[model samples]
Target: NAGVTQTPKFRILKIGQSMTLQCTQDMNHNYMYWYRQDPGMGLKLIYYSVGAGITDKGEVPNGYNVSRSTTEDFPLRLELAAPSQTSVYFCASGRQGAEAFFGQGTRLTVV
Candidate 1:
């Protein structure tokens, strides 16, 4: 089964375009997260969900949003895409205090 999956492996957006980055996991993990990796920088948490109906903002939540209505999906929404948001986004899932399973990643560019 797919541990985690992200759609639209690559995408380009106009300055103010909006899109939703889809992420889903089949591992039945209770925790899910959205992270962004910029050039030469470590992954920065964007948002996370502990379980269905529970979610929280991470270090960089501006211009983005997320929801966890079920244990298998956590989708990240970008509003008014900006160049600063351009980065490789990774969706991960795992149990608390354990190693995470990451998706191939979604490369996004805003110009």
Candidate 2:
């Protein structure tokens, strides 16, 4: 079941440009999360949702937005991109005590 899928494996955005990173999971997990990793750093949570229609901010919520309208999809929106926003973004889903399934990742570069 395509555990977790992220679209546009890679992208480059100019300063001030905006884009949405798409993620979808077929595992039917109720918990979904968005995270970002900078070079030589651990993943930092960006946003997460316990279930559809319920979302919460994480460590770094600035310049980003997310929504969970269904169990299968969670998209991350970046507005007015900046160089500091360049990083590898990941989407994950899982149960409370189970291991999470992560997407291949989206590498974004803000120039």
Candidate 3:
């Protein structure tokens, strides 16, 4: 099964543009998270959901939004993109206290 899949591996957006970074997992994990990594920095949580219909904001959720309508999908939306939002975004999932599996990552650039 596809552990975790993220679409649009790369994207370039103009300032103020909007986009959705798609992610899905077939592992049926109960814990899912969205994180972003800036160059030379550690991963910063953007959002997370423990299960469908439940969500919470994370460390840097200022310009992003997320929803979990099903156990398999968690999509991150970026509104009015900015240079500071440019980073490598990752989606991960795993059982509680277990290792999380990550997607290939979506590299986004805002000019």
Tens digits of per-residue lDDT for model 3, 1-111: 779999989999999999999999999998899999999999999999888999999999899999999999999999899999999999999898899999999999999
What is the clash count for each candidate, in the order shown? 0, 0, 0
Q: Model 2 Cα displacement at 103 (Å)?
A: 0.6
Off by over 4 Å in 1: none
Stretches of candidate 2 exceeding 4 Å from the true structure: none
Candidate 1 colliding pairs = none
How many clashing residue pairs are found in candidate 1? Answer: 0
> What's the lDDT for candidate 3?
0.95
Compare candidates 1 and 2 on lDDT and give the better one.
2
RMSD of 3: 0.7
Stronger candidate by lDDT (1 vs 3): 3
lDDT of 1 by residue, 71-100 (tens): 998999998999999999999999989989
lDDT for model 2, please: 0.96
User: What are the RMSD figures for all models against the true structure?
Assistant: 0.7, 0.7, 0.7
lDDT of 2 by residue, 1-111 (tens): 688999889999999999999999998899999999999999999999999999999999999999999999999999899999999999999987888889999999999
